[model samples]
Target: MTGHDRAPGSRIDTSKPHPARMYDWWLGGKDNYPVDEEMGRKLLAIEPRIPIMARANRAFMQRATRWLAQHGITQFLDIGSGIPTEPNLHQIAQRTAPEARVVYCDNDPIVLAHAEALLRSTPEGRTAYLQADVRDPADILERARDTLDFTRPVALSLIALLHFITDEDGAYDLVDAFLQGLPTGSYLMLSHGTGQFTPKGAAEADELYKNSGITLALRDRHEVERFFHGLELVDPGVAVIDTWHPELGEPVEGQQDFQPMPGFGAVARKV
Candidate 1:
């Protein structure tokens, strides 16, 4: 079962490509428009290994979610939960802890349209969706409370998010605000795009997104680690998404071909 969909009236915009839809395109999903494909193709032209990156990122999330579940984290609040894919966070979490509860939030109306896929919780668990942006952390945290108990430990998953948010937009402050709401022992799981290894290619991709009216801020390792400040980072600290905990999940088909996936992933606990 799932909670009610709380979306302030907003129409699905197809004129411009959305990050989530473009991401869907990268993942070979059918929930994207031509505009999104056009943009996705352009990005792929810059880096042919993008599809591998997409799958590797999902694999990282799966491994991280399973690790958290095995470690006794039963509640998940996944903000920026994009278009639903198979074996979502709830599935991985509830597989270990049947009574686990998950709340999915995303700003995209397209995701809201397909929210049902995210709501099919197991008989022993619960799921909910919220059509909201991460910028409005307060509103998301408040509504999420309806499905998740804030007093307990909740793993906040920000997978493949945050790069869209610029420092001018208070990205650090936003992360801090969400962390403040969670009690001690809560965890933050995040994956961020970086321009470190492929600086030239990363710059070109950033320009492409900028031209398409999207803000893609690929941070360096130091900048990405800033979000985990004051938290106890898990072993190996921040790492290339695929390398974080490879033993927890199976390998992606083309991940080895691409070397590093140009992203960093880490899980940190609030002490």
Candidate 2:
């Protein structure tokens, strides 16, 4: 179910712009191709602070993980895990709680190629990788169950990922399936792109991604909150990514002057 745990040099499509590789380019990583960089550059032209937005999104992941770990949630199931970013979800959670168990899942084979770096867990903690799509909730849950104890509460993180999933693809259904599979007290954490702040820029970016064969399903604040339905949302419910729990982590610089990077982030308990 892991990248290294699979056949070597397996299915990797370099033709299209995948979420993982494009995300890598956004994070200034060298794992992406020229196509990804081209698209990323286009996005940057529209939103100059894209790298800052990426960092803010990543910081949100870390803070949310830390909050969950501090609240007694030691297991994590992170879907749509992009290219191996430093201080990944596992690192943040395990750092706070040494015994944290993390399961990283992504549909991209390129991410699988670098899954080893993600697997480097603390001796007291555990980490595993799964090559799967977020749409396949049953398979992810089944595979993650091998490494995580579903009987206990888990922190499900979909950071900067759900935007790639369009409504036609049942984004809400996928979330519900995963939440339904988890026990009570489990948590659902997510940061998604939105168009509320800059509609024109968001539209341009969406068109660019569409031409590149990628889906950019940016949702509004209200729509993003739909994913947390039936769950008890934590404080600062469904705010811009940088605004949510800014006290818990370092704030993204120059964020105050910008046009409010259009995105929504929140963490909710599955009661």
Candidate 3:
């Protein structure tokens, strides 16, 4: 693994909220700051199911990682990986396939600060973390090559990450670049926030994020599927986050009681 690129004693911006920190708060983690808590609480006020959605999103990550492991996919490139929670991507993959290799990348300095928890790997496997952004697909792909074999099938997960990237930022093109860099049989796994179910509420959430200096690129189901262009979507093609193969893993508590989270998730093969 390469050395930590970020300098020690980095100043974490506690004045403004950040996605990773807010997500950490939503997941009931302590790595978040008060600013994050304030924003998360506001979001909850807007949508009471925010925490459930976070857990549901996390459940998707776990199930998808397990599926990839069982399907003989031993390499993972998970970008936009938020603050580490227990049984993270490596934990799930390594449990099913001890030899699975995982490389996690995120632009957040806080993620880098807590990256030690993410680096612990089983003796038979490997894990690495990169301090980078999703917009720079080439850098991520090039660095991931150090731990992952691009020649083989890899599950590239962008879970709950794309909403932060907008069209003007070349979101689709970045995905295409990453997919293009991988060999055939590689998979693209993603979960994206959408405005489909509740456009007004979603717009309000977007406004809040915008005012807080965050970007929420909420897309509809069709637009989210566009990121998988040319790939063969797996069974149960892009549906609400909770609908993608609920049978594969334990259903999130109260997930069925609430309106489907305004997000879609799917896994597809490059073919």
Clashing pairs in 1: none
Between candidates 1 and 2, name the one with more favorable TM-score.
1
Model 3 sits at a Cα RMSD from the real structure of 1.5
Clashing pairs in 2: none
| Model 3: worst 10 consecutive residues (lDDT sum) | 1-10
Question: What alpha-carbon RMSD in Å does predicted model 2 have with respect to the real structure?
Answer: 1.8
Candidate 1 local distance difference test against the native:
0.92
Q: What C-alpha lDDT do the candidate models reach, one value each? A: 0.92, 0.86, 0.88
Q: What does each candidate score in C-alpha RMSD? A: 0.9, 1.8, 1.5
Q: Would you list the rank order by lDDT, best first?
A: 1, 3, 2
Better model by lDDT, 1 or 2? 1
Tens-digit per-residue lDDT, 1-271, candidate 3 = 3233554566678899999898888888999988899999999998988888889999988888888898899999999998999889999999999988999998888888898988889888899998888888898899888899887888899999989989999899999999999999999999988889989889899999999999889999889989998999988889898888887789888888767687899999998
Q: What C-alpha lDDT does candidate 3 achieve relative to the native structure?
A: 0.88
Give TM-scores for every candidate, taking all chains together and pairing residue i with residue i.
0.98, 0.96, 0.96
